[model samples]
Structures are given as structure tokens and as C-alpha cells.
Target: MAGFVAVIVVVDLAVHFYLWKRLVRDVTRPGWRRTAGTVVAAGLAVLVPVTVGATRGGHLWWLAWPGYVWIGLMFYLLVALVPLEVPRLALVLLWRPTSRTSEAAETLSRRQAIARGAAIVAGLTAAGTTGYGMRTALGPPRLQRVQMPLAKLPRSMDGLRLAIVSDIHLGPLARTHHVGRIVDLINSVTADIVCVVGDLVDGSVAELGKFAEPLRGIESRQGAYFVTGNHEYYSGFAPWIDEVASLGVRPLRNERVEIGGLDLAGVNDLGGAQYGDGPDFAKALGDRDPSRPVVLMAHQPVVARQAAPFGVDLQVSGHTHGGQMAPFNLVVKLQQPVVSGFGRVDGVPVFVTNGAGFWGPPLRVGAPPQVTVMDLRSS
Candidate 1:
């Protein structure tokens, strides 16, 4: 990961230097401000790890300051990556504007072009940030309770209300307030069953403790079920499993449970620590009555393709976060069969929620965080 980041940094610096070189050709003395800014940005990137590590063992107040500072600095870094203004600036510097009218006109054209580029960058940045803010602020707290006919569902689940919330990356960004809102949203629906399809907590068990109480408040009729998301492996799955268990959310690891004439099966994350450790669906589900409905929970949507072969009725998953931001949706499409929302894979219905909380950057633009409320009815 460090190597990957270094590669990105190097490419970005190359672009910056390429622009700088071009500017120097046109402008003799463009001043030291741009040079200083570039140097400062690079220095900050280098210091990011050190700065983050320094927050460890710090006071709560002290910790928050660096966090906020880091957030701003990261945003600045993202802005610096815009190819519009920076590249245009470089072009202008590389080509000097002559006093001749034709040269002046050409210079004006270049200036206009650069101005347009800068405007585009500014617009995109503002729109992206605003969209993120709106999603964080005004996005629906949870899935709306809609009564779907039981006849639309598999034969066994005559009338089952399943509330699914995924990708609750509970770290510094998702504080007590956010968790409380999520709990309130979950409690709002009269779901007979609740499924959390992984990424319940972002960091360590200790980080999750801050919002565990509110998470504990999330309610369901039968029970709230959890599966391991990839984040769990990074955050220490063993301790997180115990912590969530204490909160009344049971972790289902390659196991099956019968509920209201429906079989609830779960497997660990496909790309997690217990990837192949769990009982195979075909094996664990073999004992289940095929005439009855089976709802499986896997952390990733990738498992749906496999579950379909086993005659699962509905498979719920997250782990994608619906790309978290824009254009990344294209990237996510290449990875997951079902990026977000309901889709039929093979013979089974798969529902992938965008997620209830965010991961990094604390931003959800095109994809807002969600609490999925799926009502299953007998077919």
C-alpha cells in the first residue's frame, strides 16, 4: 500500500514538475510562491504517517485537533491533484505572451483557456464537496418501511421484515452522534430480522467502544445478525466479534440458523482472514429444507454468485460502499457483480446496500449511506 501511494505521489509530482518546467520556459521569474507551495504539499504528504502516529496516546482534545488538521490537509492534497489549473498554469509559463497583437491575442486565448480550466476544477471540487456534505447531512437515515407482499418472496418466509445496514465504518469520523442516528433509524422499522452485512466497525475494538452503546440500541424482532467484513480483519475480528456479541448482534461464521420458517446462513468475508474457514454454504445449507426460504449474509457481494448455485433465495452484502464517491462507481462495477441495490444473480435475489456509514475521507457523493429494509413475502 505504501508503495502504491508512493507511485501515485511520484506520478503527481511528475505532472507538477512537467507543468513547472513548461512555465519556466515562458516566464523568467514566476516567483517562489508556487515553488514553496509544491514543496510544502510534498512535505505534508511525507509527514502524513508521522503526523498520524503522533496522535497516538494523546489526549482526546489533542487528538481531535490533529484529526481535523489532517482532514483539511488531505482535502488540500486532493485539490492539488486537479489537472486543470496546475497544468494550465504550467502551459502559460512555458509559452511567453509577446507584445505583438497576434501574440497578445494568443496569450489572451491561453489565459482564457487556463481560466476555464481553473473554473472547472473549482466547480468540480465545490460540487464534489457539497454533494458529500449533503449526503452526510440530508441522506435518509434508513430504508423506508415498505410492505411488500409475502407472495413475492420465497415460499417459507410468509411475512418477514429484514432490515439490512452495511459498511458502518465506525472510526473517528463516525462518532457517537452518527451511531445514535443509525440506531434510531434501525429502531424505526418494524423488522422481524436485521442483517448487518459486514464493515460494522472501521478500526479497532477500542475505537468502536465510543459508539458501541448506540450500535447496541439497533433493534429487531428476532435478532440482529452480523458477518465479518474485510475491515474486521484489519480491526481485529476476534475482539470485535466479542464486542458485537455483547451488544446483541450475533456474528454468523459459516453457519446457518432457522428463523420463522426461513434459513439464515452466513459466511465470512470472501477477502478476509476467515475467507475459506467457514462451513461451505452447500454443506451447511444441505440440511436446510429446500422447500423453505434461505437468506444468506456474506460481507461481500462476490459471494452471491456462489450462493445462487446453492438455491439461496436472498443474499445480502455490503463491502462495496457503492464506490463511496463518484466515477469510482465505474471502478466498483468492474469488481462487484451487484454494486448496489437489488439484482438477480443466477437464480437468487441479491441486495447490496451502499452502506450505513463511510470508510475514509468521510464522504459519500453519488452513493449515500443507507439502511436497507427488505420485506420478504411468501411467493
Candidate 2:
């Protein structure tokens, strides 16, 4: 835990330093403007850690909004810095031939002005994008429908509508209202089965129990089932599992349930084993009817690799949030095989949802939040 915290701190410091060097220092400005810029940059640098600490301590709920907003800004700044710097570097390289000419001073000043202008444009773009993302994040989750055809699926279970909601991340940012809205949305879908694929809450059960109460209102024919996500372990796994159960959502800990003529199983998040008990695919599928089509719910999309060997007909997952934001999806791809949507892994169909809620920054770009309804069909 200490190491994790240290890494975050170091990264935060590095990002802030780079922003200062490129956006504040390199830009030519008056003495007062420079001083103001330095102060603002320094304050933003400190705000991230301070807000995180205070919010985790659970005292000032108000700080969470601004803190997370700052976090969003920081992320955009980091992304923007790369593109912004490239142009400046190119300008320098292009001007080398005329370095000793009388036009050098003019060229240097022109280059600085252009760099400063680019910085301002980048900042505005980030702000506009973040603002739009924030609105989308706070909006009701969009519904995504997918059809999965299984060769051995039971005729009786054909057209079985399964609703998947993942990564709600309920905490200081996502409140009871958000969960209530989510419940209403799920209920409206009239799904045959509903699955909560982990990262449901960011804080402990004791801290966020009240906020999660609305989940009890979720209605489904086969009832709501849940599995651990990486965030669950961080937020006190046992208590969350029990609390979710109390809300009438079954917590499937490496367990399978035969429902509606279909074999449904759920395993702990990939990170579960690190916290003590992990996913046991063999045990979960043991004694199952192989003739029946099986749907496995694991949080991370990468878990499909394990499901393939087990002959899972379909694997439902959501951990990538489809990159949650632009370009970040490119980064997410480096980690997970699929960011969102349907794909085939070793002949098994896998559907990864963009998730129902935001993780950090309360903003999402490129990837819109969703409550996916996957209709299973027999081929």
C-alpha cells in the first residue's frame, strides 16, 4: 500500500513539474502574470494529494467535487503537454539554420508567442472537453444492446436478456441519487438477469452503505448477482460482499448457479487472490452441465483468457470503461485485450461494457457510460 501511494505521489509530482516547465515557465509573460501562474500551478500540485487525503478521511464531503475536478484537469494537462511540446521542438529544429542571423531574435520571439498560444488553446480544449465529459458522467447511463449466439444454448434460454452494470464506484462523487437513477434504469430494461461486475463502491461499507441502498430497488427475473472487483478489496471486501447481500444482491464468490435453464457463474475479480481468496474457475464450473450454455462474469476483460480454456460460451466483463476518455483508451488497450464491446477470445464470445459509472475525475470522454443488455441466442 505504501509503495502504491509513493508511486502515485511521484507521478503526480512529475506531471506537475512538466506542466510548470512547459505551460508556465516557457511562456513569456509579465512579472505579475508569471508569479500568478507559478502560484496557481503550485496550488494545483498540492490540491490533488490534499483532497485525496481529506476525502479518504471522510470529513469534508464538499472537497471531493473540486478535488476530483482538479484531478481531471491534471490528466488533461498531462495529455496536452505531449502534443504541445512536439510543435515547439519542431519550431526550434526548423529555425537552426538561421540561428546567427539578425532575424534570430524575431524568430525566437515568434516561436515563444506561438508556443504560448498553443498552450492556451490546449488548456481551453482540455477545459471544454472536461466540462462535456462531466455532463455525460453525471447523466443517466446509456443502454447498449448486444446479441450473443451460443451453439449449445438451451432453446428455453434463448433471447435471455442479461443486464450488466459495472464500476459504479459509489463514494463521495457518486451518491445515492446516482444509484437510484441506475436502479430505475435497470428496472426499466426488464432484463431476465442482471449482473453487477465489480468496482461497485470505492469506500468501505460503513462509509458508503447508505448511498448504496438504492441498489435494493433493482428488479430482474433471476435477481441481481455481484462479484468482487479490484476496488471492492480496497474498500473492505468482506463487508461490501455482506452489505451487497443485505441489499438482496447475491455475491458469487467463485460460485455458479443454474438459472432459467442456463449455467451462470461468477468469479472474484482478477485481483481477488492477492487479497486472500481469488477466482477459482474450476471450482465454480465443477459439476456443471456442459451441454448447457454458460455465461461467466468476471470484472476485468482480460479474464476472458482464463474463461476460454473452460469453454465459457460467453464472458461478460467491464474494467476498461472503453478507455473512459480519449487517447487513454489507447493506453488501456496496452493493458486489456478489449476496451469495450464484443470480441471473440479463443472461440468464446466476450462482451466488455464501458461500465455504468466513472472511476476517477467524474469525467468520461470517448467512452460513454452504459448499462449493457446482452441478449443470448442459440445458434
Candidate 3:
């Protein structure tokens, strides 16, 4: 599909430039300028779509690139459709082509045309600037925190607090400074335990060396635990797991950590071998004391359905980015049983965060980034 789109774009650009060059030869005046204009316009039109597509990852971006390019073409048509009435009207009045032209009338016509052109340019500029600015300023970043009460609590730790941060895609866009900010924010939160669901890095374990400094600052009374997201699988999971552990962040791969009479289990990406074909949530729980509360950290929330039957009390996940876009919430909805926010699947409770850092575009359109603060309390 990407190949097909690339072919169409290449062909379209070729035909456009070919016709534009022909027009330049036939036209008597300002032909070179028109050719230059066409070249510049085509260049601008093509690059934006490609850039938008390359930046957006996951499956939808794979399909949207071709259609998105055409969307850019529509934006071009909008700009051209704007009427050039003022300049043409001034030409009619000043030249008076139907009658004898006066010197004063000619000067006035030229001045009016220039003034009207400047006004049109200024108005368009202001509109574009205002629209972009408003969206940027008002489009709140997708970050949220929620705490829920537990009806059945473990006696050993009745009111335990847990801070969950996930999808910190540390790469070119999520630099050291951005990560440092998150580290500071997480530290500021009052929690007994910290859990990082997954997608710690977007590219490679090499990224760890750069951002590892901030991981030192992430603090909790118990410790910080991590699980692998699908991105981790693509981004060199082995080295990343080692690097993360070196920073004191325990990467739990189909493993469990006992904390304050509660069982905390971290599973590998459902796609990985550690999960063994398809993960059996009850198996992960094993024969551990069911009387004590069980907290499972799965990168994706679909595990909730299986975990609920096993009496898993709480499951924390962060992969959806909470739809990331307004209407696309439907897509995220269809894929995951739980889209975002807090929900109870049968008997088990699930908390899916939008994530502390963004994956692509560095822009959070609909779902604001979040550091979820969950405090477990006995009923």
C-alpha cells in the first residue's frame, strides 16, 4: 500500500511539472514566474503529507498516508478558491478599457489594487495564524490522574498508593529534558508504589544512555516496576530490559513481585514467548494467596477480560494513548475492550492512561498526556 501511494504521488508530480513547463513555453509574459510558482506549490503540497504520514506510526497511519496527501490537495483548492475581486475591480475602474483612460484614474487604480492585495494577504495570514495558535493553546495536553476506592482490600496494606506512568516513548521527540520533567512530576506525587506499564523507548536501548539520568529520580516507597509494551518488542526489548534494570527499574517479564502483602505481576508483551502463545491470566496468578490483593501490569488492557475471572483486583495499562484524536476514539474503542480512563471489566478494575509522553507528532490533539495516581483503599 505504501508502495502504491508512492507511485501515484510520483506520477502526479511528474504530470504536473510536465504541463507547467509546457505552459511556460506558450505564455508570452511572466511565464517563468508562473513556472516557478507551480514548482514551489507542488513541493509544499507533497512534503506536508509525507511528513505527517512518516511521523504517525501504528496501523492507521499505514492506510491514511495516501488519503492524507489528497487532503493536503484540498487545502490548496481552498486557498485558490478565494475570490480576487478587489484587484480585478480596480483594474476595470482605473484602465476604463471601454473608454478613454485618465492619468489620475490610472494612478488610483494601481494604488487600489496594491492596497486590496495587501489587505487580502494580511487577512489570510491573520486567519491562519489565529487558527493554529488557538488549536495549540487550547488543545490541552492529554494528562490525567484518577484514584478509586477498592471494596475488598488486603488487610496488610489497606490504603496503598500507586503511581502509574507509561508510554514514555523516549526518542528524538521525547528528549532528556521532557523525560526529566516527567521524573520530577512523578517524584512530586505521593505514592507508596510506582509502576511503568511499557513503551519506555521508541528506537533503541542506546536511547537509555541519554535518558537514564532521569530514571534515577523516579521514586516510590516500594519500587518502580515495568512491563514490555509492543513498541519495546520493536525497539530492542532485550537490551532495553537490561538497561532499564541497571537504572533500578525492575523489568518484570512474566514475573511477580510481592509487596506489602499484595502480589504485583508484570507480564511480557502478549505477543512474546514469555506469554506463551496466548497468556492465561489465571496461570500468571498461580496459587498465590488470593486473599491478598493482586495487581497486574499488562501493556495492553485487553488482558482485563481474562484477569477478571482470576480475581485480579486492579490492572494497569497504557498503549491506546486514549485514541489520540477525537473521532479516532472509535478505532481505539474497537481494538481494546477498555479505551481509556477507569472501568471495571466484570469484577476486575482497569486504568488505562493516555501516557506521560507522546508517541508521535509531539502534539496531543484529543487525549491529553497523563500521570495516573491510583490509591487502593479497602471498603
Tens digits of lDDT, candidate 2, 221-297: 98899999998888889998999999999999999998867888999987878888799989887777788778899
Consecutive 10-residue window with the lowest summed lDDT within model 3:
19-28
- Model 2 alpha-carbon drift over 4 Å, by segment: 57-59, 92-108
TM-score of each: 0.78, 0.93, 0.68
lDDT of 1 by residue, 143-257 (tens): 6444444333556556678888888777655667877888788888777888988887756777567566786777778999988888778677788888989988998988889
What order do you get sorting by TM-score, best first?
A: 2, 1, 3
> Per-model C-alpha lDDT, please?
0.69, 0.86, 0.67
| Residue 61 lDDT (model 1) | 27
Model 1 C-alpha RMSD to native: 4.9
lDDT for 277 (candidate 3) = 31
Q: What is candidate 3's lDDT per residue for 170-194, written digit by digit as tens? A: 7654557767877777888766888
Q: Kindly give the stretch of ten consecutive residues in candidate 2 with the minimal lDDT sum.
A: 93-102
**Clashes per candidate (backbone, < 3 Å):** 6, 0, 7
Error in Å for residue 288 of model 3: 1.8
Error of model 1, residue 347, in angstroms: 2.9
